[model samples]
Target: MNEIILKFSKESPQVKDTPIEISVIDVQPDYLYKFNAGIDGIWTTIQDFSEENFCIWKPKIDGKYTLMIQGKKKDGKKSFDAAAKADYIIGAVEEDIIQSVNIDRRELLQGEKLSVMVETTVKPVMYKYWISGKDGWELIRDYNSENEFLFTANEPGKHEILVECKTIESKNNFDDFRTISFIVSEIEKVQITDFKCLSTELLTDKELIFQVDARHEDSRMVLYKFVKIDNKGKALCIQDYSSKRMISFTEREPGSYKLLCMAKDMYSTEDFDDRAIIVYDIKPYKPIVIKSFTTDFTSPQTTGTKILLKAMVEGGRNLLYRYMIEGKHGEDSGFIRNNSFLWETKYPGEYKLSLYVKDESYSGDYEECTSLEYLVEEKLFKPVKIRDVALSKDKNYVKNKPINITVSADGGNELRYSFIVYKDKEEVEKINFGIANWVNFTPEQSGEYELEIRVRDKYSHKDYDSHTFIFFNVRDYIPGIIDYILIPSKEYYMVEDDIEIEVITQNAKETLLKYCISINGHPVESTEYSKVKKFKFTPKVSGKYNLEIYSKNIQCKEGYDEKKETKIYIHEALPVTNTKIKSSLVKAKRNEEVTFVVNSEGGKDVCYEFYLMEEENWKLVQRYSKKNYYTFIPFISGTYRLLALSRSFYKKVSYEDYDIFKLEVN
Candidate 1:
């Protein structure tokens, strides 16, 4: 292969519009050659020549570009290829010479000298200086080698200084120059005539106004500055510059302070005039209070009344009021923002009512608490009397039974009772019942007895007591012969089965009493009988039953009869032997409907119950009485049973029979 290569005179990055020379080596003669240049990595044909070895390229825009050259024979065969790349950055055609300038001061009084100097990084071939004042810029130095100059400002205004230079590389370039400005004004003299506050003595957090009076030689604007001098003679600026004549300041610390006021013109060699000082004395704050307090009502107030309580406080911005009654804080007492409150009286007595007042200043150190005693007299109550007294039971009671006694009274809030029991006109027992109205007593022996109840109001005197009495007969109590009975003698029983219920007695005293028997809640028989009481009962239907037995003697009272109850269970009996169901298939698909017909020895009124198998238990699905057959579709694959129950129209006993069927579902 014939190889082609490209070379450049300068490999460094070139500025825009700068020319670069490129040469192509090892070129094949009389063969087609192409030179390509890329802008931002894209290659394009720049020139296509047959035998050229060198080319000039000047980039107009600044960027990185790739240059490529390729050569081939006229028959379209590859011969040589070369490439070169460089970056081009934008730059000025000439270098910048002016760096910076320096001046002694920017502000000066009239007739003051000003010094200015110029500096440059590159050596300049020429230098020029000028000054701009009331007239246009006047040439002060032309083509001078020295870069520094001095001038005086006689007029009061702004003046501009300019310096122009040229580098040795480009002498015709005058674009590089440095300019600076300064201000000059006439001097003025001022003095402070008076500096005094409204009051020299002040309390903490109190404001004082300080007025300044000054005179100026020139009719220029004057400024006032206030400085505070501590006990150590250190000055601190309170107000820097204020055009106003008076200023207000508040002292927050207890100390002695010296306030100095200075007056000066807008432009002066001396910064401030003779300052006038004022001494101030600040003292710690002490709150003032007036202790005049009063209430809406006087002493000896009636019980159960509402009274208004108030405190008139003066000379405090934030005041707190608290109230108490008889050493107990009232409900409206803690930190009250208001001064007045309502007090509801509770009991009839003398009470100490107190009021505590405080100001929210200085951590509530200044507080005033005062107390006064008041009397609450009791209201007169009417005399009370016993209206009626009653008993829970009849006055004639058994000898050993307890009786409840209660009383009704009028015109009193509280009452007392005294219960006394007497026998044969002699006191047996006396009970001080206190505030209770009822008492229970048991007479030891059967005899004539009397019960007396005395009642009195809580506020009644001994002469106001009332008494009442009732005569009662105590009778002897007799015991029963039989206590209870237990039936079936087992946990459960079956229907149509003969069950013997045993009768049990307290002492086996059968000859002294008459016995009555009831089974299934119906009376069976009653007689003066033996102890065994032999009887047989057969339940017709499957269910639960209750058996009751009562024993009584003719000589005993009517309520002295003893009774007992027993619960029994009777299970269902199997149906007749010949009862069955006729089905087409013993096992069928779950989605298919199966029919069952009842087949029995004799056709009669029968109810059919269908049960499905669910979780090891049989669940009744449906029951029908008017139809002899049942049809159902099983949703789940399982075993099922059908119960055929028959009962005669005149008898309560029912007979049942069941058959199982299996099913499968896909």
Candidate 2:
């Protein structure tokens, strides 16, 4: 026969040695009494085992409970009662629920704290808890209801947490176990930055101060390390540094220096990793000088001034040195000296001065430098003198018009000459002829004329001492007319007439004049005297008449010239004795043809006479005779007389003066 027991717990497996307890209860009367290896067969009769110990049942699954058995011995003995079946009703129980197993954090830092928790539920009751690992858990707090267990991790790694449950209270059998595993981890790490320097990259007798950075979450100190790196990447740690942040070195020889730096956290308490770097070299530097430079100072009058010079020096530093002088008196004072120097002079004759320079430091390897110089000059200008002078036309005294002044210089071309002419103390003419002697002038008014001429010599180079002056004048003249008269004089008989009279004065200076001729208060055309100063006229009829002349003076240059008036008597011709007739013969058709003709001898105031043989009276042709000749054609045969007679102006001449001619018929 077998026995069964149940128990519970909520602590880790290490705190308590076991989790359950087992004991016998009651057994059924039946045939199953087989017992082996501490697990027993089904119990049947309580009375049959009441004298012996009962067996335990280890519960591993869920199901309804009953029992049946056949009685058997460890040996081959058997009985029929042990084979009978037994049935009993037992209460069902569940395994404790292991709800969760987990770490408090997924990630962890260096040595920070971490935790693990186990959560569970009892199916029908509470359970015992335990964890399996190298180091046991540190229990923090506990909520005991057979449901949860929490603990802190002492170290880092995987651990197995477990729980077990049973129906008995003792520390053995009929129990169940459930488990889960978890993990933990370790911490973080450190580095450095390269060094920086500000001095010239190629060093020549120079030193440097530098800086670098350390990289870690914590603060730290760095060490400076300097080394000389060869052509390869291998590193060597150098120790003679002045500071972790800065250092200086004196350059002795020329080569390259390699460098490094390192840092560590103060908390790390150890030296930092070697990682920073810097590199460079060293050589020589210097400069040079110049000495003793000079110029000249004396000379002659026209030549102006002079200059003089001298000097000494150094080499490789200057390589090739030069010297120069300029400004006032410099034209005569310039010169050049290379390498070394000596005394020198110039004759440019100047008053202002200056100097110039060049050397080897400025010119590269193979070339030399060139130098230049300058200076200013000075001078004085002079004037001239004039002696004898003359003119072309001479007057009784100084004239009111232009004249010539001829100047003569004893020094000739050596003189610079100038001239001026004055009238009544006022300047009228002036001229400059450079260095020449003769010049001319014209003045406007009559006065005491004064002429001045000046002359200068070239050798003195100045007008302040060697110049001369001279003086003279011109006279005025007025001209005149010699002969005079009116033109065309004698009057005989009838032809038209004109007369012009003029005055013949020696000097008649005048603008416009007027003239007239008159007879007894009426106008006529003649001059009263043959020498009248002026006159004019024309005649239309012939007669004896009185003649007169008059003139008005407009303007005359001579203040005393005169106006004019005069008279005379004139005679002209009557045409009577000078008369003659011209005739033309005509042939009519023969009914007794007849004609008459006459030419008149008379002035404009005249009429013609006509006498017919048949008429007792003489008929006059009132308008015909002024033509000098007349003609008549008679219708019947008869004799006629054609006569011309004089009319007005009879008192001035003879009235018996007439002309007659006859006419005949066949």
Candidate 3:
């Protein structure tokens, strides 16, 4: 039993000149299909030379088409004329079709990317995209099957994106077009957050504390500055810009004061990222007096190390505080709201740490500060002692190859090493005690060698603090190339034929091979050293070419092995195009023999195979061989469908060309 099914690349309602693919599915045994199409019940044969199951075609006229598939079976004495048909319509081309275009965002900042997609009634054949920015129009993408694109907003201004769509078989540049516009702005600026006065009283004698908070994108660092403006509008610097957002100060001549606080990003390019102002009047208040200032820290600490100072005050309100370090590395902590500080210095000596406190507003720079003595002893590091020197010297070392030596030591803050190489009894190379602890030494000549490593800290003054040594040997190598051969052993080389190279080697460890080419005794090209065992060379043009190959050891100073092939001729190639299948009889009786022959053109050493698609799968009637003919005899009554496939001996693919033929046995 046999049933036919048809599949098309495009559905009905297609227009003229639209390419379409048709596939026939007949899995039943002894079945093959013949395709034909027409408008009415009567169908005309379609002249398409394709596979027995598939074909491609384009409709030239606009109308409805009825496609018919005639099926047959390869057997004896049974009628196998099973048939199936399908309908396809060719509609008129419609103009002014609508397309859908959408964008991810309408507004964005410069340096951001936007996504857009276009949609139509059917899949378009091609799409073109263009972007219009401050620099006029630019083609973003050319004709392609993609419906989406990512547009980058590099300029700060109005921008537009245009997309053109083309459906199947359309000749115009675009069948439908759509556009979208967007606006891109610059980077966001900073703004001043809320500012608060932490002090209880605004008086001249008392300490006043002010804290400002601001942030632009949480992870960005913000620095703050505080300035005081008098009644005369003249600005005086209270505290310069710093990462600390709190400040404490005492105003002696306090009247009407306007405080300006500004916040900015640490790396912001603007004058001020954000700013805020505060207006207030100062009145006379009680003087600030330090009652009992307590501090905690282990003294006699090492220099060049960070130490924390934990401080607590019992003064007025402790609303404002300041710290000053007096020594070789002096620094002022400026008036801040925090009481503790971290100090570090490279110099070691006597030092004094002082802290001043105030309650609220200030009158003058009087006293409310306490001092603490610190003994910063010099930090000493131990001399570098050689611990372990690891090396892989058991393996044979060849001349001219690099030897790497590395050493590790203990008990040094900053250690330096000196590598000394000795050949025989004489010194060859040496690096002074520097930060480098690893070195590579290449032996220029075969010899007995010794490597010595010495390590010392920067503070050590002796000739060496710790030393170690190792011994190794280097040996010379011999180079030789035995022979080489070319594939396809042809007298005349073709212009487009691939030739393989096979090389045999002797004492081949670390041997480098080079391929040199020349034309008529003039050198044209030479390749670098490689271990090429399976190299393919394809000739592009016909010429009298000379090919030379050489092998040598990279570690050896001079000797090499060479081979050459001279004055080889290359000719143009002939291409295999197709094969034609012919049959002796179109109809035959039961048990009658049928003969089929295949003919080929421009083929080189061609071979043929005969196959029959009579059932669920094709059965091989004849395997690939030099004989170009096939003989067939049928038993069960049906039709015989034979396919001939031809391939060249040198071709890598399965078959170059094929043809189908039919024979009916009644």
Candidate 4:
């Protein structure tokens, strides 16, 4: 029997063919072969030159197992095979291990597309390239078959491309793979480096300066837009600048505004970068214009009335406005020196009103003038004046006489005069004379009379000019005083009541006098009065009598007699004192304590009887008692009376009085 040997670069003891000493080149091969029988007719050869090294072995038992290597002939495959049987096993390993998976890009920008090229060297396209965490590797353009793969980055992030390669084997299959890491960073659509305002003064024809930077892994022509904001802060239409470094906004109107700069790559229109700037227009401020001026009432009377004038301006201008009044006499200043003015006229005349307005920012004098014409007349509503006022008592009046008043006015129209005669600022008489030259008034009552006579012109409205005088009313000077004194008595008189009232006068005075007699303050008209002064009367109702006499002269002046009273007490029998007691709810709770009191009908401490009665027929609580007062308390709730019978000190005074009282205890 003969044995065969195989060799490998690294040891694998599972194989039977072991070689004693194997060459480094022959140890790892594209394929391995084995034999164990005597040689019949097999020959070994390297069929194709595909891998770096292709080995063959023809083991035959002509005498023993033998090896043959087929590689480059000059390298002497026979010499290497003879040494393999001594020490090496037939194991194979790949010579080319994947060192790394290399990618073209490391970082990518957002919304940017980039083509990535993958490079690797392994036999027979040993490794399939894959973008890790995604499906199979996507080929962008087929160049160099699958040996080189191309892909575009869709997102910005770190990514891995995995390369898996396998080496062919005779007995045990073996493979090797590795991963390459890459990053995709965010990218700007436009490359505007210096997007800023060049100068604020040139904002009307504003110029924007910007620069595009080509620092990305991919180069692309980009479109940029420069937008300017109006004074209202609204974004205007975007202005396109193709690959331009400077954008100008000369088409914009004059004002302060802002500018926004953005950029877009020709490939990706969605990506943008922005910046802003401020602008101001340095134009002169225009003065506004005055439009119109007028008044509330342009026509006014000259009798001390004020005329108002108002001035208005427009067109956003500052104005100095004033009004002046010029007439035949002279020009006069008005109440206000600006805008609105008031002019007062002294008398009935024609007047001129001139309104002037000036742009104070541009000139020191007025630029606009407005004028109005006004005619003045005597006042329609003048105050009334009273003159030539006379009273019937010669203006210096006597007492209690009919007074006549006359009032007249001098100018204007015929007037309706109203006369109010007052004794002391209080109206004594009122007379309305209809459209008269003069008015007459008579005072019915005399004192110090103040006459207020007001005359209002029929055409004008006015009142109150007064003529006042003082007078006295003497009693004897009045007509009605009794000349003859008469004492008359009534034809009939009752025995208990009689009185006489007398009438006296110097002439046949028609004055009626009233006489009254009263008991206390109450009148007793039922009592008869004697017609004569010498007549007599008997008192009926026993009480004090008061006589009051009242008279007045024809002038309505009051004269009265003082009260005369006489006291009399009448007695037909002895007077006795009666008594009673009063209280509410004598039986009550502890919080509602009870109190009782006795009441009497006469003077205190008179002799009387004291009794306590629970049932009918009261018993004498005080025997033979002269005391008029007593007190008692019931132990329980019941009804009782504490009686009192009092007698007066006079011989005819004796009485019985009793108080019924109820007691309650809680």
Best by TM-score: 1
Residue 169 of model 3 has an lDDT of: 82
Model 4 Cα lDDT, one tens digit per residue, 291-400 = 44554333544366555566656532345666777775445453233676765566777878777665545444555577878666777654344445554554334454
Number of backbone clashes in candidate 2: 65
**What are the models' TM-scores?**
0.25, 0.20, 0.23, 0.22
What's each prediction's clash count? 1, 65, 26, 59
Compare candidates 2 and 4 on lDDT and give the better one: 4
All models: lDDT? 0.64, 0.41, 0.71, 0.47
Per-residue lDDT tens digits for candidate 2, residues 105-170, read 655443344455545454443455555444332113322334454445434566555444453352
The global Cα lDDT (0 to 1) of model 3 is 0.71
* TM-score (C-alpha, index-matched) for candidate 4: 0.22
Top candidate, metric lDDT: 3
Candidate 1 segments exceeding 4 Å error: 1-209, 214-222, 228-236, 249-258, 264-271, 277-288, 298-300, 314-317, 324-335, 345-355, 364-666
Tens-digit lDDT string for candidate 1 (326-364): 723234467677787777766777778777777665375
Which of the predicted structures, 2 or 3, would earn the higher TM-score when compared with the native?
3
Cα error, residue 387 of model 1, in Å, equals 43
